[model samples]
Target: MGAASVKPTSLPISELLSSRYPARVPRYQRAYAWNDTQVGDLIDDIKLLLPLPAGTRGHFYGGMVVIKITDSSEPSSNVYEIVDGQQRLATFCLLFAQIAARADELKDQADSQGDGEEAKKLAVLARGVRKSNLYYQRYDVDEGNESEQPRVRLSRVDDDFFQSLLDGTAGPPSRESHELLENAANLLRDELVTPATDATDLADARGKLQRLCDAVLLDSFVIHIVSDSRSSGYRLFSVLNDRGARLTVADLLRSHTLELLDDHASSREKAANLWDDILTEGADLVDDFLMTYYTSLTGKRAKREDLFDDVKDLIFSATKGRVEILAALQKMSGEVSTFKAIHAGMWPYVPSEHMQSVTEWQRSRLQRLVSTIQHKLSHPLLLAARAHSREDEFAKLVHMLELFALRYKNICGAHTGPAQAVYYAECKRLRGLTNGVAANFAALRKALNTLIDKRAPDPIFRNALKDKLRYDGGSPMKANLKELLTVLEDYRPWIKQGSSGQPRPSMINLIDLGQVSIEHIHPQKPEVIVPSLTSHTNRLGNLSYWAPSDNSAAGNKPFALKQPAYAASVVSFNQDLAELAAWDLSALEAREEQLIHDACLIFRP
Candidate 1:
C-alpha cells in the first residue's frame, strides 16, 4: 500500500460510527484481548485531562492502540477504518455504557457521573442502540466442554463484569438493551448532551469530555511514516518509540541511542547501524558483558522489563570495545556471584511460590541484581566468567535449566500432579549452593525456575507467573503449565515445607493444587449453557478461579440452578461465596454501585 495519510477533523465522532472494516477481516487477524484496566486508564485520562488536550504528541512517541472496525453499507454512514486509536474507542464505548446506566442516580453527583441534563441529553442522543450497535452479539460456548456449541444466545458476560453495568441501567429497555444503548449513550453524555446543559458551574467539566475527543485533531500529530514493508514498519515503530521515555522491549531492540539525526543523515546512518547490531540476540551477549562492566562501576540494572534504560546506562559507560567488552564479560562471573551474595537474605522466603510476605525483599533483590550486573563489570568473579568462560557459564546454566525444563515437561504430562513441591525443592537446592561459577549457574537456574513458579507455584493460589517470562516468546506456556499442574494438585495432597524446610515432606491438603481442566464458574458449551463468563467484560473480579469439575457442575445453571451444588461445595467456592455475601443482593439490580461495591474490594491488592 502507499504511505498511510493523516488528516484530523472534529465532528460528533458520534455520527462517525459505521461499519469500518473489510467484512472478511477475521478476529484471528487481531487475535488478542485487552483487559478493563487498560480501558479504564483511557477513561481516566479523558476525565483527568478534559478535552484530552494535545496532551502528548503521537508521532514524537508512537503507540499502536488497535481497534476493530467493520463496514456497513448503510445510508448516512461514516466509512473509515480505525487507524491508530482503536483500543480507546472500543473501551470508551464500554465505559459509556456504564455511565449511561447510572445517569439518573449520577444526575446529582457531578464528578461521579457529570450533570443531570447531560444524562438526559445523552438518553436522547443514544436512542436505538441495541439494534444499531453490533457489540452485543455475544454467546456462550457450552457448560462442561470448551469446544461445545452455544446454549445461551444473549449472554454477553460473566456475573461480575457483565452484571456490573446492568445494575443501574436507567430506562425503558431491558438491562441488556439498556447496556447496548449506553455504548453510544456515553458519546452523547460526553460530547453533546452533557456540555450543552451546563451554563457556568459545570462549564469546564461539561464540555471537558467532548473537548478531549476534539483535541486529537489539533493536538495529535502523525508520523506519516514511509516504510516499504511490515519488517520496516516494525523496526521504524520500535525506533520511534524508544526515543521517548516509555521504551518497550521492541524499542530496546530497535533504539539507536544516538540523538535523532534530522539534520545529519550520516549520523543517523551510523546510529542505525550500531542499533541494528546491538539489537541482535548475539548483541544481547555484548549487552550482558557491557552491563557487567558498567555495574562494576556504578550500581544499576539491565533487565528486559527495564532494558532500554539499563542499556542506556551501560552504553553511557562505554569502556572501549572488543578488548574491554571481552574483559568485562570474563569478569562477569564474579560480579554475578557478588550480586547473589548481596541478595541472599531473600532466598529462604523466595523458594516459596510468591513473595507477598516479602515484597520489599523481592523488589529490592530485583533492583540490586539488575544494578550489580550491569554496573560492576570488572569485579573479580565476573572477570573469570567473561574470559571465554561466559559461554561456559551460559552453557552450565543452560544445562541446569534443561534439567528443570525436562522435569517441568514431565509434571505437565501428569495432570493433577504436585508440580509445586517439585519446583520448590529444586529452588531450595539451587539456592543452597554458593560455589563461584556454580553459583552463577545456580543463580541462572533459580531465576529461570522462579519465572515458572511465579505463574503457578501452588495452582490453588492466585499467582500468574507470565507465559512470556520463560518460554522465549512462543505459545502460552503458563496457561499450558497451569493446566498440567492443576492435574497434579487435584490428585495429590497439599505439598508443604518440611521441618527441615524441604518441599517434599508430605501431601496433606490442597487440589493437584491449581492444576485441573478449565473451570467455568458459569460454564458454556453445546449442551450445558452457563452465564457468559468471558463476555461483557469488566474488571476480572467477576471471573473467580474455579476447578474444572466445579466449573462444569455450575454450568448454565443460574445461581438458582446451581444452589444445591453451591450448598454442597460451599467450602470450595470461597471467593464467589464471599462476593455474593458482600453484595447482599442475590438477583442483581440496575445499580453500578452494587457491582463496583462488591468488586472494588476483591480487585485491589
Candidate 2:
C-alpha cells in the first residue's frame, strides 16, 4: 500500500480502452453521473487540444484513472477494477461510439458516390473504431472459449444500457438507462452528426469527421495509475483525485466512515443508509452541509482542502469507541437533514414530529433573512437555534441574526473574516449553553445579545446606517442592494391591512421574484435636467427596483418622461416615486431621510 507500489503511466485513450486492459466498475461505486455539461466540456477540451503536433505529450484533460490490477500474468487481457475516473472513461467510450457511427455513415456515402479510394480510407477508420481496444476484450473462461466481450463492464444498474448504447442497438434511450448517461450519449451524438453552420458538402463533412475521430482516439491520453491491491488502489485514488474532478471529499469520507464500522455490520449499514439519504439531494451538497456542520460544531471555518482532515480529526477526537463513533455519525446525519431543510426553505418541515414548534410564518421569515443576507456563516447558528429553542425564542434569535448580519455585512461594509469569527464564537456559545444546561432560551438570547451589542452596538449600527445612506452610493454587491430594496419596499405599518385582511407588505416573497435591477429614479446622464442631483445618482434615494426590461426601457430618460412608466408600474416603491412632483436634490434628500428612518426600524438591533 506504499506510494512506491503505485504504478503511474500515460497511455493513449485508444490503448487504454483497448482489449489489453478491460476495466470494471465495482458495485460500491456510484453510478455514472456525468451530464451534458461535463461531456460537452470534455469534448471542447479535446477539440481545443486537437491541433497540437504529434508527439507533443503534456496536454492534460485534467483527470487520472486508478485501477486495481487483478491479473498481472495476462498482460494483454488484464482485468482491473476501476477505482477512479469511471465517469471520464465511460464518457470517452460513449463519445467514441458516436464518432464510429458517424464514420459508418460517411463510408456508406463514399460507396454511393463511387469513390473507391475515399471509401477504402473511410472503411479503415470505421474498422479501427469498431475494433478498438475500447470496444471489446477477450476473457479466458474455464470452458476455454475465448470470445470477445464488451471492453468495459459497469455496475449491474447501467451495464446493459451502456453496452446497448455502445453497440448502437439501443433504439432511443430506455428506462433502464440513467438520465445522465442518456444525456451524455445524446449530447455526443448531436455534436458529432449535426452539420456545422458553414455548410460543408458530404465529402468534406466525412473528411472532417474522420479527422476528429482520429484525433480523439489517437492523440488524447489519460494518466493511468494501476495498483496491485485494493488498499493501494484507494490510496492512489485519494492522491490523484485531490487535484482533479474524479473524486470528491464526500466520496473519500464515505469510504473512511464505512471503514470505521468494519466490526459492526448493522452500524455500517445504517451509516451507509445515512450517507445515501444525505446524498439523495446531490453529492455536491454534502461538502456544503459538512462545512456548515463543522462550523456549527466547532465555531471555526473549515477550508475545502482541509475539510476531510478536519472531519477525520473531529470524529477521532469525539470518541474512540466504535459505539460512540456510530452515535456521533448518526447525530451528524440527522443534522445534515436539518441543514438540507433549512437550505430548501422547508424550516417548518422538521423530520422529528416533536420538533415542530417553529411555525411556518417564522420559518418563512428566517428563509427571507438568509436569502437577504446571502451568507452561510449564519447557517450554523440558525440550525442550532431551530433545534434547541422554543418557537418564540427561535423567532427572536432569527430577528437578532437578521439585524446583526444586515448591519455588519450590508450597512457597515465590514470584513467577512471578523464577522464569521464572531458568528462562529456565538455558535459555540449557544451550543455550550444547550449541552451544559437544559434548553434556556432566555439565557441563549441574553448571551447572543451581549455579543451582538459588543460587536455591533445599537449606536454604532445606527451611525453606520446613517453614514452609509448619506455618503455611500448604491451597494456594490447585488445581493446587498436587493436585500436593502426588499426591506424598504416591503416595509409597512402594523395597522395596514391587505385585501386578505393581513399585513399589506409591499413585497411578500422576494426569494421567488424574477430578475430585478436597481433603477435610477433621477437619470444620471447630464441631459436629464436636475438641480444638484448628479452627484447623488447612486444613493439609496435615487434607486428603486425595476424589472430588467423596464430598466432598459427607461434608460437615461428624463425623470418627467420616466414618471409615466413609473406610474404604470406595479411595485409599491416605483408607484411612490411616481407621486413625487420634482426630481431635485431636495426631493432626493427627503427620500433619503425617509428611507433611512424606515431602515433604522427594519434593521434595528
lDDT of each: 0.34, 0.66
Q: Number of clashes in every candidate structure?
A: 71, 4
Per-model TM-score versus the true fold: 0.28, 0.69
- Candidate 1's displacement at residue 186, Å, is 14
- Candidate 1, position 459, lDDT: 40
**Cα RMSD for candidate 1?**
23.5
**Candidate 1 lDDT over residue span 248-332, tens digit each:** 3333433333222323555435444443333333333444544443433333333444555554545423333333433433344
Write model 2 residue lDDT over 254-355, tens digit each, in one string.
666655665677876776666655565555777788788888878887788788888878874424566776677778777888888677655634446434
Q: What is the lDDT of residue 478 in candidate 2?
A: 49
